[model samples]
Target: MSQPIALSSEVPATCRACNVRHAGMCAVLTAAELATMARSARRTQHAPGEPLVVEDSKLTSYANVTDGVVKLSRVLRNGRQQVVGLQFAPDLLGRLFGRENLVNVEAASEVDLCRIPKDVLEQLVATNPVLKQRLLDQSLQDLDEARDWMVTLGRKDARQRVASLLLLVARRCGAPGIDDPDRVVFDLPLTRSDMADFLGLTIETVSRQISRLRHEGVVQVANHRHVVIPSLPRLETLAG
Candidate 1:
């Protein structure tokens, strides 16, 4: 069973200033509802590699990411593992009605979370129609992303897959406030090995493709994690 972490001193009051308020589960909630949620929610932090939800375990809570990233993956009977998805800030975690967790959810980076007990979340969803609809919409969006990734895995070559993954991450990160959308800067949350797992490629292939993109001037690597894209249009063409 997962243990509850103590609430951070900054919670509740800080909830009001959260960037995801309008886009997250709190969107449909009124001030009173938000207050109620704030009271029930506890802030928690996880360091990289900490497991938020262990595979096959009983889930007792659901959480919203307030900072950093979380990774969702599963291991086969043979012990081979694959990274299935990533959850960034503002993304919801945990299956709403599910009893047991199907995958391991881990902190991919230093992470902050606002966690509500599963029972509390369930009760709220049962009584709030708008909240339920928001959950349904998020579910549909997840489904669409999964389908799109399936196509990328099945149809794209190594280089195209790498480009596509960069594009996806850039979209998630959004363009840095520069006037040009074509010039984007973001840190890669996934390691090369993680990228290989997601793209269905070998680690060597993933690295080779990234090097090729850098060599061709499609992107500039500030370091192992940070990336700068000079031309979004060119990257999209390469992704195709």
Candidate 2:
């Protein structure tokens, strides 16, 4: 007798192929639930610097980052913007069950997203305990990262701060693991200006630090945006 097909196999073709579906919050979803979600989830793309959410906007939908990076920023009272966070693929893109968005979300790189209606997602969350836990887990994980970054900003020197950011992007944005390869090459997700904003450095400072890293042979750049980490461990030591 033939074995029964796996439930994951029954997930819609589009969803079955999605990396996000296999990890993050979506991992809790059963095949039928994924099908229902996929029926309403719209795939969308954005170029670098495109805005995805405005601060204080009505929350009518939620998104899953299927590819590329997102920037989370907020406007200060003085009219300057501060980048508070970055989100990567397979991550949920906004606050859960919130009535209004608290921060602005923008594409940090060419991005692909799967958008689900707010009502639909909320309803699913209400019914699925596992899904709710998954969402909460991700939220808590983000909070932990934020706290760690506070230390990076407050205690670390400029070079360390920059290395921390590079290590962060490489780890989150699909670079090879240390166990798999000593080297990692990826498109740098944030521009120098954006990195300066995120890291609390001036653009020139950010440039100098990157150049310093290149000089040290810790990292290499090509065509401006591609970052090649010849040794992730060496970079991680600097991040500390």
Candidate 3:
């Protein structure tokens, strides 16, 4: 895929892709520092279901999601897979302090990611106190997300699990007052199998639960990919 537009000192502006949006890092970055960091970045694209990194692969660079989503998962000895987390637009990947990879990462949709060389990114963060703090803060948030997923897997049923997942995706990408119009419209980026894997359900069960929701007029399938939730509170109860 084509690399993202180049950043030049002549322009003296940071490439927007380099800023960590989810953690709110951009506002604190001085103009010059943002530009400096931008020059060291490149962007690339991946098609749906493409593996960005595999378990135990050598760590070369870090990525910031520009568009689309990615899922992180691990395979068990018996060949079952468990999805540990999902990263949406503006999220970072490959932030390990001293490892290649512990899980596999794959694109859940057509994706664009801004890539930063590992050593250069480290240098940039170490030299910039604000960026360093921001990275630390992001790490903490990620830890919390992981913990929440454990609860979803251990405590929630198929319906509740699906509900939780939907709420999460909506909150991440949904607009303000998502329920104001009595419909929450968003894309269901993951396939049924992917959803099943992530939620610890069988594909048949996932399909059944989704069908049940649609049959009950709880959600409307706008297309093969888009979903419209007619009642946010009802969905919340289903998820809980």
Evaluate all candidate structures by whole-model CA lDDT and list the values in order.
Answer: 0.84, 0.88, 0.76
Q: 74-95 in candidate 1: lDDT tens per residue?
A: 9988998899988887778988
Query: Model 2, range 174-225, lDDT digits (tens) per residue?
Result: 4775666878889998888898999999999999999999999999999879
Residue range 100-209, candidate 3, lDDT tens digits:
87789999988888787888777777776777776777789889978988888999888888788887777666543443854577888789999998888999998888
Candidate 2 to truth, TM:
0.93
- Please identify model 3 stretches exceeding 4 Å from their true place: 1-24, 176-182
Q: What 10-residue stretch in candidate 3 is worst by lDDT? A: 1-10
Give residue 187's lDDT in candidate 2 (0 to 100): 92
* Ten residues in sequence with the least summed lDDT for candidate 2: 1-10
Q: Which residue pairs show backbone clashes in model 1?
A: none
Residue 75, candidate 1: alpha-carbon lDDT = 96
lDDT of 1 at 235: 92
Of the two candidates 2 and 3, the one with more favorable TM-score, higher being better, is 2
By TM-score, how accurate is candidate 1? 0.91
Off by over 4 Å in 1: 1-12
Query: Quick one: ranking by TM-score, best first?
Result: 2, 1, 3
